[model samples]
Target: MLALTNATVITGDGRTLLARATVLAADGRITGLRAGSGVPAGARVLDLEGDYLLPGFINSHVHGVTFGPLFASGAPPLAEEAIRRNLVRHLAAGTTTVLSVDGFALPEEVAEAQHLSPLTIKTSAGLTPAALTAAQAVDGAGLTERHLAASLKEQVEAGAVAIGEAGSGHTLGGGGSEYMYIPRRIKEETGVEISPAQARALKEAALGKELDPAARDEAALQAALAGAGLAGRLTPARAQALIAACVLPGLKPARRSIAEAAATARHFGLPLIAHTAPPSLAAVLAAARAGTRTIAAHTNHDSFTAGAMLAAARALKRAGAILDGATFDSFGARRTTESPANLVTLLKAGLVDLITTDYGGGFFDPLPLALKAIVGAGILPLPAAVRLLTAAPAAALPGLAPERGRIAPGYIADLTVLARADLARVRYVFIGGRQVFSSEVTSGITSSSDV
Candidate 1:
């Protein structure tokens, strides 16, 4: 249905990347990707003018829960138009594919997808339901085994794409044992949830080895460590409970959390989109326990040691795990220079991560902003950066969609046309054989013609 020619193609498919080629798209699927300068007859030719064309984005994690104080009297945050506008932003940002956070889809997505229409959406809503925090303490309540089973059944019916970033912020779930720690001061001192710095520090400290190795055995070691207060806030009793319930995924009989997420996905067989980023390690350990190869979004805000991250990745790989850099709102505000630089460093070091847009908020495609940050921060080479946003994420996309990220034959024709020098600034976007947005002009439909 469309031929994108004379363009510098940045195929996110990992194999054919940064190639100067022609991409043929029909019915929203990539029909042909020839590497020469020839065009088929009678195809409406849209010359990219040497701009860049790549697969539209696949965003993994984002909190679309009432995007305001959960207890506030706001007008049902993320209302219909709000969701629509936010989705538009995703389109504008060249995000043809996006996995909305938690279990809620935008109103537009529901309307569009219910008719069996062609809008890229996937989920495991039943197994892992995620909400920022229904109540202040609700953040702790991730999906229980019971919740996972029930929710997964419904998700299969509703067609949810994956499980969740199921943990609570200042949650009260997991026996109040393996909790997201809020410093006694922050809880008593201020109203903000958790400081990013503290989170980073904790991640750093976790890489250390201090488990009762000196006691010659596990129990005497617990006593020796407890004497030293080396266990930190994780009380021995609470830690044991957490090990049984949260940490040691080996003991579970029913497939709860990660295993539940995987089994549901594998049973009905959907890709597990674990809501993550800084939150991924916990989920990864849990999912590995369950023997599922799921994708963790955003992986987190902390600066993890490369060795630790690699070990984690290797472990995940052995268990067939995939990790994505995981983030939301490409058009969202840029982080402080110091913070973003750290993320860039991790990306460059060959850490197993991907660029994912956290869609479902203000409507804006993320490619532009995300590209800007990667480049501005000086992370990868220009082409590599583009690939990070394109090819990398596509590989992590579950279910026969790897081709979806590239401009090769048999690939899905979800593509974006943008400036080569600037991968984010959108010039035109096409998804599923439709010209979703175009910046320049449309024949017989000028603004003046409308009048």
Candidate 2:
């Protein structure tokens, strides 16, 4: 048995916080939690010295940790070492469970990677080619409806948990793509290479009108194109087409591909995860209406202004769909669509249903850091913030809710220990009742007792 004492336990359920408590675990399950120093004799005890104990964070949306190419450059699948390193980073950041969104990696490969890590890893079925292209417009790799359905079935049979990240703009430069692929593609086509900042500026100029590509300012578009060295090389029409293709791909067809994918996911009894942006709201709603339990991923994505995000969030909530807020590389800097202020707006308004890190544009925003920031900003209470990362995500995904994401007895003994002064400073991580990580080993009485 393992006994953890001298801690303030925030039990991820949004209503429990046992100050100076004792948590007991045995056989990979939480046996009990009670007030203070109730260690059973012969149990190994680690005195946390008043640190904050939390249920391990559960990340509902992640990519590039297993089977996906790195955010840009079309690099090869991440190597085993790279995946392990990413897992370690997540563990160090207090993430004990992660749902890796779709990519090229097989379900079996994702399972193998999970087997090697102490973190509880889950995988989603890969995306259809049309959906894939809509997100990024990659050449080739389109899938027929038949093939897409078959693949999703196969993955579900192979233990896949969800059908996710149904669409994204990263590949097409809708959100963070401006930092990478969009500029690369522009340069490839017109020999006009642009910087990441310029790409972001262009994305704002083209997509700022919210689903109305025709509302784009021609002069501004020309200036952005010229600033990227596209002057005289590409017509304004062609430039607008490129921008539209990147930011609003397939929306013109009324998001047929997204609806189809969502229907297929519903057929398989899996929740459909779709990218959430102004232009994609219709698709998200379509999926929800199609009877798929849809998750509007990154509802506060940078593409939408704060007002638009709140409105969309309320609508998604009313639709009985889940609203996922990703802390996309919003650690110390606002690197991607996720800003602390935006996330705060959602949280304060009670619009965010779950929290995750969607690749964080390759930086993989640390959940704890984001949580700490929100809590410190006085935007959200600590216990409520913990639930968004834990119970909320676990509940959002049926596969994880019952077994993990809580500190109550019979729950999986996945726990994170944070320093009292710095909530982001994870000091220890326990997975399945095993001490998988520790910043420092402390002396404790033990021999036959499990640690």
Candidate 3:
């Protein structure tokens, strides 16, 4: 048994905040919460000294251990040591649960990796080979609907709780594929290295519009290519085709593939998590209308302007779809499409149903940084922001709520402790009632006598 006393407890139920509270736990479950130091005799005690205590964060969207290739070419699966380091990073940032949307690795492999870690991991059934090609026509051979259905069913039976990242931009072509993969592919082919700005121009030229491929200006395309040192090496037609192939490999929208994936998700009664941006909004909404409980992942993608993002998010919410906003590498950064302002707009408009960290283009923004930014900016109430990281995600995914989101009796004691002055500074973390991390211990504690 353990007692945490003299803390400001944010219960994560969206309504409770007990100042100078005491939380008691035993055998990995919260026993109770009360005011002051009500430490039961014979129980170990950790005095928080008026720090803030809350439920450990739940990240609804994440990828790294097995899906590193989504952001960089030839990036191998993270080794066990690297995976452990990543998990420690998350724990240090206050996250106790992660849903790894590994697009290529098998569910069994992911589960095996999870077994070696302390973090509670949930996985999704990533796109099948047929679904992958249908979405982007990449390297893999396509699978039939019958085969896809069978495969997903097997994964669900193997403990996959959801189906996603149904159609990734990295695989299907939006920001990730265009900016991350396309530039690398262009360098590989033409031996001309392009800047991120050039890649953005290429994306706009090739896939700016949903159905129209000829929407961009030729002069601008040439200028962008020229800026990237590809002026005389390739013809205009070839450059366009290469750019298009980098994003929309075989199909533009891949409507059939998305529909089949949605159907499979519905058949399994699992939430369908789809990648959505300005170009893919139609496909996501169509899937929602087709009766799949769809989660519009990263609704505030960098591709959409602030106003357009809010409008699209409203539409998704109206269609009974959950809008997920990712805090993608936006900590203490200037305002951009993926900045905190966009996420704030969605939250202010009540369109953001959940918050996540979606790869963050390899930076992987910590949840606490985002929470601190929003709460500090006065755009979101601190309690509400805490709930978004905890109860909201739990409620959004059904499989995680109530049990892990609130600090109450009968709930799993996964909690995070942060200093009152620095919300981003995680001081301690408890998973299943065991102290997995302690900043003080890591900083300089030498022995039991130090305490």
Q: What's the ranking of the predictions by lDDT, best on top?
A: 2, 3, 1
Clash pairs for candidate 2: 136-171, 136-172
Q: Count the backbone clashes (under 3 Å) in each candidate.
A: 36, 2, 2
- Over 4 Å off in model 1, which ranges? 15-20, 35-37, 63-77, 104-119, 127-150, 168-267, 275-283, 303-319, 328-332, 335-338, 359-365, 372-395, 400-403, 441-451
Q: What are the lDDT figures for the candidates, one per model?
A: 0.49, 0.74, 0.74
Model 2 regions lying over 4 Å from their true place = 68-76, 127-150, 171-173, 187-195, 206-213, 222-254, 441-451
Off by over 4 Å in 3: 66-76, 127-129, 139-150, 195-197, 209-211, 226-236, 250-254, 332-338, 442-451
Alpha-carbon deviation at 28 in model 1, angstroms: 3.6
Q: Give lDDT: candidate 2, residue 285.
A: 81
Model 1, residue 2: what's the lDDT?
Answer: 68
lDDT of 1 by residue, 30-55 (tens): 78877765666656566676887877
Following a full C-alpha superposition, what root-mean-square deviation does model 1 have from the true structure? 8.9
Candidate 2 is scored at a TM of: 0.88
Q: Compose the digit string of candidate 2's lDDT tens values, residues 1-451.
A: 8888888999998878889998999999999999967678788888889999999999888776775443322235667787888888888888888888754446656767876677888877755555544433442232333333455567678777777666565543355566656776688788777866577666666655464665777678778877877778878777666766655544443255567668778788878888787667888987886678988888888767889888888888878889988888776545554356677789889888899988755676778888888889887889988999999988888875458899999999999998889988888899888888888766443533454
Worst 10-residue lDDT window for candidate 2 reads 139-148
**Per-residue lDDT of model 3, residues 1-451, tens digit only:** 7888888999997777899898999999999898877777777778888889999999988877542223212134666776777777787888999887754445656766776668887877755554555533553322334333456557677777777776666655665665466778888888877755577776676546462466756787787777778888876677777777766653443444556668888988888888887666888888888878988998988777888888888888878898898887766432222356677778888888889988755567778888888888887778888998898899888864349988988999999998899988899999988988888845321222223
Q: What is the Cα-based lDDT of residue 194 in candidate 3?
A: 73
- Candidate whose TM-score is highest: 3
The TM-score between candidate 3 and the true structure equals 0.89
lDDT value, residue 229 of candidate 3: 82
